[model samples]
Target: MTAAKRQFHADVFITLKRLVNDPEGIEIRNGLHNLGYDDVSEVRAGKYMQLQVEAANEDEALASVNEMCERLLCNTVIEEFRVSILEPQAT
Candidate 1:
């Protein structure tokens, strides 16, 4: 019998580069300080995305996820991304 293709889940985190100015993050930080959280120093806004892909192996799944991120998920010029493979949990 042929082996069934495996399904992979990818967790993508897209964050703005340090050199890029983040107005949203600054606003949040200011709010926090006003709320009495003076210890808070910096805040960075980002996006989190989950993707499901069908592939033969982990490598293939990762490659597909990376392509998706580069093409649609993240702006490579001003943003950076990280990918994590989530293992299936037991029932």
Candidate 2:
């Protein structure tokens, strides 16, 4: 066998559709109202995750993330996702 190589890092954000019901977001909006800030209209909730993956290059890393979004982390029917890749900063 051969050794593995590492390439890119990614950050993913998964959020519910604007029309979807989010209990957590509702609770937060209610709390904000109770706290005397009542100008908010609607609130949508979301989640964020960071991943460090090993791939040949940026394209491969993106492909991995795309598969992950479709198969596991995101519900494409009811939710949307945003993926951001972080290049190596420096030495």
Candidate 3:
């Protein structure tokens, strides 16, 4: 008999590498400065994604999500990604 798959929630964060230029981030920072929030010196824009997956365990879920990130969610050349697996939600 096969063990039932469990639902997993993944939070994926995608960001450009530090060496890459972030025009959107710079624009945001400039806007903030114009608004008198000069304390905001730097702003690095990024993407946040939530994914729901089915897997046997946390490890499997993490592996799948990592693969997803490496394959499609992020650009390895100029971007990096981080994955966080939250506790499985109740059915």
Candidate 4:
């Protein structure tokens, strides 16, 4: 008998650093305030991506996704990234 390869799903969020200026976020916040949503305090714009990865285990999958984020998905100089692994639901 052979072991089957495990598949993992990841959700990645890429956002600008706190010190970095986000014009789009500011614009959206202003628009919301103008629309009478005065309670809206801060708005931050970011990128969300879902990836299906094939790996032997959760650690391997996470490592691969981290590398992808560092190399291509996010700008490390001015952006920060977060990864969330989604557990497979029972069928």
- What are the lDDT figures for the candidates, one per model? 0.89, 0.85, 0.96, 0.91
lDDT (Cα, tens digit) per residue for candidate 1, span 25-79: 9999999999999999999999999987777777878888999989999999999
lDDT of 3 by residue, 1-91 (tens): 8879999999999999999999999999999999999999899999999999999999999999999999999999999999999989887
TM-score against native, each model: 0.89, 0.82, 0.96, 0.90
Model 2 local distance difference test score: 0.85
Worst 10 residues of 3 by lDDT: 82-91
Once fitted onto the true fold, the runs of candidate 1 whose alpha carbons sit more than 4 angstroms away are 1-3, 89-91
* Model 2 lDDT tens row, 1-91: 7545565789999999878889999999999899988899877789999998877667778889978998999999989998887774434
- Using lDDT as the yardstick, the better of models 1 and 4 is 4
- The TM-score between candidate 2 and the true structure equals 0.82
**Candidate 1, residue 30: how far the Cα is off, in Å:** 0.7
Candidate 1 colliding pairs: none
Model 4, position 87: C-alpha lDDT score: 66
* Global CA lDDT computed for model 3: 0.96
Candidate 1's C-alpha lDDT? 0.89
